[model samples]
Target: MMTRSRLMLAATFLLLSAPLAAAQDGEPEVDCENAQVQIEMNICADRDYQAADGELNAAYKAAMAAAREMDEQAGEMGEHYVGAADALKRAQRAWIGYRDGQCELAGFEARGGSMEPMLVSGCLADLTRKRTAELKAVSAISGN
Candidate 1:
């Protein structure tokens, strides 16, 4: 009976720490689809946001490159275009600030709860995907 009790305690401790461990390790221990606990769910949410952020970064880079190309073309034609890349850099910085604030507000519904991180991450993913689409459009327009 003592051994059984000890095993139960061990299981409880593992269960409680699983989410924290996964969060710190930056990888979920199980498949996202199979995530049933709060930590697993949060981990999955974070992963989704990370994927979206990756796409956004790629799109932003393409857009920046395209803008620089445009500036070069204008320069070769004896035309002056100032702050082409600078403007894009500034816009991206502002957008990041807006996205963070928006997600923080969205998470207010679950404030101080276990689900707040998931809520914030989901919001961030949604906004980031939208931003990626916008950057892709910019890249296309800039002839990248």
Candidate 2:
């Protein structure tokens, strides 16, 4: 029997490999909006996740700025040093691990199937978007 980590690793490998294989074969650029086959779907899903990741990065930067602002305010007001930025950084790191593990578990339902990569990527994209929104909201509330 395969371990859970092995299952996740295989799915991740396939997700990474699909684009390279498609490119090497000279496949036309995928129309993600109308993806038909499993490989194309997987590639498009990965692309979506990548785009979400980019947005997440931007949100994280904004959140960090807000956190620093919070820290500065606390220091100026003679309140305890909030260390907001450090706390946010630690939370973000923990969130990343949680998101990866959660998405891997989601893909487990389709393990060893062509759909596993797509499932994993879709979960990643969805979770990343949610995290981005959360970060944006936090920044907005904390003096962004």
lDDT of 2 by residue, 1-144 (tens): 999999999999999888788799985488999999998899899999999999999999999999989998898877677788999999999999999999999999999999999999999999999999999987997867
Clashes per model (N, Cα, C within 3 A) = 0, 0
Candidate 2 has a TM-score of: 0.80
Candidate 2 clash pair list: none
Backbone clashes in model 1, listed as residue pairs: none
lDDT of each: 0.89, 0.93
lDDT of 1 by residue, 49-128 (tens): 99999999899999999878877777877756645777889999999999999999999999999999999999999999
Off by over 4 Å in 2: 1-22, 25-28
Error of 1 at 48 (Å): 0.2
Q: Estimate each model's TM-score.
A: 0.83, 0.80
